[model samples]
Target chain A: MTDVSHRDAGLLRVDTDECKGCGLCIEACPPKVIRMDESLNPYGYRTARYAGAGCTGCGICFLVCPEPGAITVLRAARPRQSTAPGQQARP
Target chain B: MSSEPEVTWEIASSKPASFYSTYERKDELQHATHYCPGCGHGIIHKMLAQAIDELSIQDRTVLISPVGCSVFAYYYFDVGNVQAAHGRAPAVATAVKRSRPGSIVISYQGDGDLSAIGSAEILHAANRGEPITVIFVNNAIYSMTGGQMAPTTLLGQTSTTSPRGRSAAHEGYPLHVSELLATLEAPVYIERVGLGDNKQVAQAARAVRRALENQVRGLGFSLVEILSPCPTIWKMSPVESQRWVRDVMEKTFPLGVLRDHTQAAQSEAVPIPPPPLSMIPGIVGVADAGLPAEMTGDADVPALDLQVRVAGFGGQGVLLLGEVLAEAGLDAGLEVSWLPSYGPEMRSGTSNCHVRLSREPIDSPLVTHPDVLVAMNEPSLRKFCSTVHPGGWILYNGEASPEDCDCRGVHVLARPFTQIANNLGDARAANMVMLGALLEIAGNLPQSSVDSALGRLVRNPKWLALDETALVCGRRLMREARAEVSHAG
Candidate 1:
């Protein structure tokens, strides 16, 4: 819901040490690029991590994050190339 | 270089990033807050932080957190944080706002804190239209104190104290805080919002912002009552708690704007300014009088600073005597204070007052060792005679001073002050008679100031005439007693 969608293209990084695996961020992400990793964080709860290259750089995960500074979304300038081959990716 | 252009966006918290909690947890906790998962306080904190960031008021914002779950709000909100006593946030906030009127003071309180113990403080502060914002969180039960029955606990709701369902006959009805505060005239904005769903949460956010906005605009007394979810105590899942708030809690406390007087209040002119301090003497009817010659702070009379204690039965005008002395001292341009203490009984019970007069500002109103003791009866004389300072004077209203009482270095002026007042046809004027004798014995005032003070105090013309005659008789009796002592010597 924040203005991070202005660029329409970005990457995400979640701090494994700070994420409680609350999954609120996962529920909020429109692209579903965020997922709780199988590997346990230092405190033992599964930490959230970027799943694939489909991240739209939308900061919904950051806004819904209870832990401040846990999620960082870096947005890119132009339209991103899709991981899929041959088929035209819809915007 | 055949690549997509760089968007260049970084989601580092928010700009009031300073407003968010980047706390380094001692225990390495993952969450920014200590509140349990799905607690509405976390959401409310987020909304408030966003509002503060948007308004750019983080520097001037002062959050007063009282006891209960939000007691550790200082750790979350990175503003001027103040921890108030369990139920005294409104009072503390009042002083803070009044002293630093530029600052935005917010009193954050819970149901148990605001409704039960702090009811009077909030009511009076809101009634006075103090320019402060209050964020009241009603979670139905006392969550912090192990989920006890709160004033806002709904009927049929069970808490630790209300083991069974809350009964109307025994427990009474729930207190609608938003409705109660809305009844007050001073509050410019009042709303009750819930955090049940996204729609409700959005409405709550707006209410919080509007409440703070009213404060920013110098509007008086705004409060936003947030019906938050206490999932841990409610023994429900976080999602279930949300449903409970929406389906169940909303029935008891409906979500809506209860009142909004902001536009009307802002257009109205400010109230009249307070009168100047120089006008007080005139207002109290003491400006026209000429102070006695001896009271002009002369070197010959010596600076008179008297701490006098008057003690007697409740109905004997003991406090009245102290008041007259204090008023006369003020009329003579001296610093004065009068403090009274009495038992519960209205009459015949013990009563006392301490009166202090000083050329300089008085330090304290209490007189543990009085320079003068005016004992209205034999029991009062015996009780207080020992505490008189050495070389102090005691004016006792008896046939004769108690011979066995150890007055030591204290001088005694035992006389029938009441009998003299009775002779003047009013026994109640005895206190005025005693005042006359005390002033004459102290040899400070010219009796005119005392008369003016009596004129200011008493309203009836006939009683005022009788009191004037009584003062003359008291001064004459003091003169006669001095003469008798000199003759014997």
Candidate 2:
């Protein structure tokens, strides 16, 4: 099994200013790595929050979230060690 | 939080570059959209923007936004935007794509817009096989105008209009748009996708992208129908509304590709570019007849404003007189407007026309108070003589001006113009005689402009010669009348 504790796969950031606290991302997240904040933002709705770990960055949350800039997903770069003999790393 | 080594991160998905960084639709909500929480338009807009960004066509993309909650789409998209009237997006998109083949035109419409009022526009555009992409968002209800039943509203669904839930016997069955469009032969791609779940959303994004790609390849008539959720209108939580779209809406409108002729379809022929603006007059056979050099430039001309109203019986060329005056004004590089009002009967029915010519732009074609009035008969004289402005001129086609008629401070040129024209060989040329008197009074339109306008309008050479003689006789009579008035004074 893959190591779930390692933070190597992906990271998620939620722009609270733009999020409407729809919770669509929380429900659609495959790893269940997103949650609703305990307190509401200035718009008076509890916004989505990234759970500190276990994000695979499949971008399902980004696709399902209605807000354009609310959810942004970042995937970890592939390790150089996995490259073949003479294959240069992509910029 | 121990790690062997830190891994670098790259952005996988964010806001598309095609979207404006800040929506200027409203003052307060610059960073957010006008859509309600969990509205499908936001997601759909993102998908469309992403497609435009990927194809690198943002510069040439022209989005025809329909009348709906998305009418303000221009405020968000950083591309060419046109807001079409309710349901006319397809018609507007066809015109845009045909006129500008280089543009990537998209018609974004909702269920009520596409299927209800704009049914004919969408049908004919698709029948013609226009090369454009259409994004049809079906929420089964008119969410923007409150929860009202739409053409695509499913049976047993309650709305403001269908309070008892739609009954098949009463409201009829829901429209299956994708299936209906797939029956047509011209469409190259037609698909129905939803935003009910993660998988569905992924498919919808791919479908949206593919529709745009098909348009880029010159394939004809691609549409993607999205089964979206209206959480506010449905009175359900955002997540519950999403579930309803998957469970209930999907049963009525199945999710899948209904038509896919993209592989077999050939690219459409390149549209012929329209002729240059300067060549249009030549192509229409109006070139080089005798358009003056002044017609091309108005800067050197003196300021002039003339308003004339001509009224007579239907057969009396009253409208033709007005047309000649306006056409002469145009040939003299003046702004002109001609508006004709007449009765139904063509021969003896009363007819009148208003003409305005000015060095500056004419505001309106309507002339309520004219500076000059050409009354061809006693009835026309009595009807319009009072409406003439003070210090204006009145040309009455009679042997003598009526004593009861008010001609105070207004110059009156009363003559038997019809008798003069009859002597000149054609009584029908009376209108031209009155026009000649009018030109003498105005003194702005050159004789050359008037002659060319007459030559272009009057085809038969026999009548043309009679009209020319009548015009010269009318001018001589006007000069004599003015000289007699000066002597009497």
Candidate 3:
């Protein structure tokens, strides 16, 4: 239960433009969720990568990365509020 | 405003101002971090940003991130930042602040990056009073490379390199860098703080802020040397590591200010007012821009008049003798240099020294070949016996009597250094005894100069001062044997 409070576990994003071929993220992820691609980015790094639902978004990938702006973690969207303030529709 | 610490955390009374990401939320705020959970780096990063926001110097500040665990410092700080070469932040910061005098530069460095390869760079920059702020995170061991023994590792502290805890008599004691830099007149602020508790962490934050404030005031060379924790490398929980730094490490490295000019109104080291940025030299060539030696102004180090190498085991005082010889030569108005080969291979491995003594200028201090070889072990004799200059001496440890036939044409002295030290009762004295014998045989020091040099060295009354021991032992070794008479046909 305490794990849910971890500030770093969130939705993830990627900054492809700054990504280098260095796959430190793929290596660091505990879930084995990310992989590299043959296609290269503008920086000539085989900079493309992909991730899956296995990404619990620990952000260790974001942390261990050498390249800045390469990894992003986006939080899950909040549910929209009802028309009435402080109210929710019945289940 | 200087030393008083600010609050660490505050829950939103309502909500943080719009467009300003909340410090705790995991949404857009997540973009601010690229760090592992439970990593102590997170705490440091947050503190730096908080201090920046509080001070409102974000626009003018320039952060320097060197290659290390903290290399991604540019990511979190919403300011201009440049990446520096590995172990070159101090040098890079030195250049940046000089180039853009209006811009405040801050160097964020780690133990290995700052104190290992970049030691001299840091010393020289601080010595020159460079107007830059340096945040040195000393985690006792290197974190970026897993864990290696950093120069500041405490004696008996374990690391990857020192699996058997560092030995004080071998790896030597932890370097007190803040204390060392405080000795220099260049730095205006110096402090060492740790983050073991709420109080200590708050103090660490304040130390960093004090350095930043000094930069805003145009003070030269402000440094906050933080004793940070690398829980992953330290093999402890974050809490335990914090306790370790606060408790165990703090025993050796006490908290509080090492030096702070802001505390007092007047100090001997007032910040030198900035010169017009236009007048300052830039990255490119600018000759005669060399401050007259009058500024760095000291008598130039003369050229090496003699070159010697001392090779021995880890326990032997081989390196100390080499440094002492270099200091003595320097005292005698001769240019001198001493280089000891001590890398990952220092213990139970090949150990040697390259000392160059010159009458003119010494360009390169490394002795690829030796004029004299002071060998205290079989390896030293076998390796360096061939390199000695013709008609020069090889001072081999007399206890190990290797046949002279193996080293043909090389003058050899099987001097009993250990036996001499036995007379002295400290086994370590053999190195001094060997050095003393060399002085008698080498004749590099003129009779008049040798006594003056020896007298200057020993008058300190400090027994076992390496240089003094070298001098006395050198004299005694000469006395033990008659000076080899020069033979002429």
Give me the runs in candidate 2 sitting further than 4 Å from their true place: A1-6, A80-91, B1-3, B276-489
Error of 1 at B454 (Å): 60
lDDT of 1 by residue, B369-449 (tens): 999999999888888899999998899998888888889898888888888898889888888788777888668864667
The numbered model that scores best in lDDT is: 2
Ordering by lDDT: 2, 1, 3
lDDT, candidate 2, B316-387, per-residue tens: 899999999998888887889999976421113578999999987777999989999999998888888889
Global lDDT of each model? 0.78, 0.87, 0.67
Model 1 TM-score, 2 decimals: 0.55
DockQ leader:
2
Residues B1-489, model 3: lDDT tens digits: 334232222221111121124222222334334443235566566566656766787787888997776776665566888999888898888777866777778899888888888888889998997878898888888876668898999889988899999998779889888899999986788999876665666677788787887777776678988887776688875556767888898988888888877654232343345666566665345734665353222355432367798998776877867876777777767777899974231112456789888776678988866777889887778777878887677888865447653666666677677776766655667877777777665555654555455555556544446444555775666654454533321
For each candidate, give the interface RMSD after superposing the true interface residues on Cα: 4.3, 1.6, 13.9
lDDT of 3 by residue, A14-77 (tens): 6666555455456555666568768877646575365434335455455444333456654433
Which candidate gets the maximum TM-score versus the true structure? 2
- Model 1's CAPRI class? incorrect
Task: Give the TM-score of chain A in candidate 1.
Answer: 0.74
Q: Considering summed lDDT, which 10 consecutive residues are worst modelled in model 3 chain B?
A: B10-19
Query: Which runs in model 1 stand beyond 4 Å of their true positions?
Result: A1-13, A23-34, A47-91, B12-15, B20-31, B267-489
